[model samples]
Target: MNERLNRLANLPLRENLQGLAPYGAPQIDVPIQLNVNENTHPLPAEVHRAIVEEVSAAAVGLNRYPDREFTELRERLAAYLGHGLAAENVWAANGSNEVLQQILQAFGGPGRSVMGFPPTYSMYPLLASGTDTTYIPGVRSADYGLSAHDAAEQVKAAAPNIVLLCSPNNPTGTALGLDVVEAVYEAGRASNTVVIVDEAYAEFAHTGTPSALSLLPGRERLIVSRTMSKAFALAGARIGYLAAAPEISDAIRLVRLPYHLSAVTQATGNAALKHIDTLLANVEAIKVQRDRIVSELTRLGFTPASSDSNFVFFGGVKNTKAIWEGLLEAGVIIRDVGIPGHLRVTAGTEAETTAFLVRLEELLTQGVNNSPS
Candidate 1:
């Protein structure tokens, strides 16, 4: 390990990336794995067949470069979103991470900056650094909530070139009200800030929760990003996209690689969009399990947050590390997101959720120890 570190240090790495660790969650091979916020439900047979058929057709054209514009995929995505968006208003990349990275490359760099509220998605700062943009860390409330007034105040004060808002925020599972998005956008108008709302977990959000996509009508600077990885059960397919003004997609074109999205990826995303209703049925099931996790966690004496996503973020653990390890020992793994008394767990299928809850309850009852053995 020391030799590997020394080798890396000797290489001419980018200054910003020198000391950084790659982003990832534990991929432990446990029977009940809920560490990452994945839609643990399997795909429906019809969707599976559609993807297979689409990929098989796309495979025949592997000899040629894919359509640089990916027009059909964009059209399908726009129709899926259904806020009167057109294909020209959409852009996509390998995944949402790449989509964000492309955004940073286009709009952020040295002398520019991006701001994001902390205890939020961990990638915003990394993306900023990778693009040589300064990252401004904004704060959240004591309970990890951000209000419209406070959010607007912070935006007005910072005036960053780019702003990232994660709705149904990661590691917290709470959605931001559109009021906050509107306020932040209004506040950033003075700075001409490009605001991005990442709705990776939007499909799992509670009923009546409005998406930031609803705010896109008159706001050319606002971008609403979504991912098929979570709701469409397509994590391995790596399709993430955004809806914004046509000019935004045009701007991203300047920074995006030629034919960045492959033929197979376009085919897969198009096929999945065809079966949107079927895939979303699974989202409803996940929501049921999510609510169950929140209810059961509260009853178990843990302070679970009001989750709008498919995961539950809870505190009130006596020994977080101990409980995490205890569950691992019991063949059920969840996320210990480095918060002192807090952890996040993905709401998986019914059996998977039950396995996690049962193991967690047993560990709490045992008063599991965190100290080194």
Candidate 2:
């Protein structure tokens, strides 16, 4: 591996790309896999049939390029979002990552910067780098929390061209109050900044967790991105979209590849949207397990954070590495998010959740060292 890396380093890669690692989570196979925050439930059989039928129809037209506009998908997405959004106010890409990359391409590049709070989504900095945009790591509170005032103040200080906010944030699995989005957007106006709220996990958020989508009515520069990969159980389909002003879609068009979203992708997304209720039923079930994980973890004496998303991020480990390895040995796998004393786990089916909890309890009983590693 070292030799291969050395050979690649000699190639004429872009300066910004030097020595950067690719972004992804560990893909280890395990009995109960909950590392990536995927919806563990299988797609409803009805939705599965609909997707196959839609894809089958789309296959007949493979000879031609997909609708470059993917117009119908946009319309359906808008209807699903339902905040007075129209097709003109929507755009989509393979996943929210690509949607965000396009945002950086349109509004950020060398000499421009994008700011994001640390211990948030790991991808934001990597995306900024990939787009040749300067990545400014903004500070979060000591406990990985961000308040509206502190967030606004950070934006004012950085004055970046783009700001990426992840609600019900990754790794931490907690939702941010809309006041943070509102405050940050106001602060960014002075710089004409493009503010993006990544609500990739929004569907799993606990009740009354307000979305930044509600703040979209007047904020043209603000964008709220969502994905079918999570609650919709379409991770393999890779359909992610955003809601913003009509002009924002037009701006992304300037930088987007021709026919970026394929006909099949559009079809699959539309089919799933048709069964939105059915797919979302799994979200409630997953949330049940998520709450259980939180409650049970606290009872086990691990300090689990309050999570609105379908995952738990917890601390109070004496040996983080030991607990992680012990869980792996027990045939369950979760994420060790590189935080000093905290780890994250996605809520799976009741059985999967039970397996994880039972194994975790056993590991604690067996006295796997908790001394921080």
How many clashes (backbone atoms < 3 Å, residues ≥3 apart in a chain or on different chains) does model 1 have? 0
For model 2, residues 54-137, the per-residue Cα lDDT tens digits are 999999999999999998999999999998889999999999999999999999999999999989889998999899999999
Assess every candidate by TM-score. 0.98, 0.99
How well is each residue in 88-160 modelled by candidate 1, as lDDT tens digits?
9999999999999999999999999999998988888889989999999998999999999999999999999
| lDDT (Cα atoms) of all candidates against the true structure | 0.92, 0.92
For candidate 1, the lDDT comes to: 0.92
> Pairing residues by index, what is the TM-score of model 2?
0.99
Q: What local lDDT score does residue 48 receive in model 1, on the 0 to 100 scale?
A: 98
Q: For each predicted model, how many residue pairs clash, with residues at least 3 apart or on different chains?
A: 0, 5
User: Model 1 off-target regions past 4 Å?
Assistant: 369-373
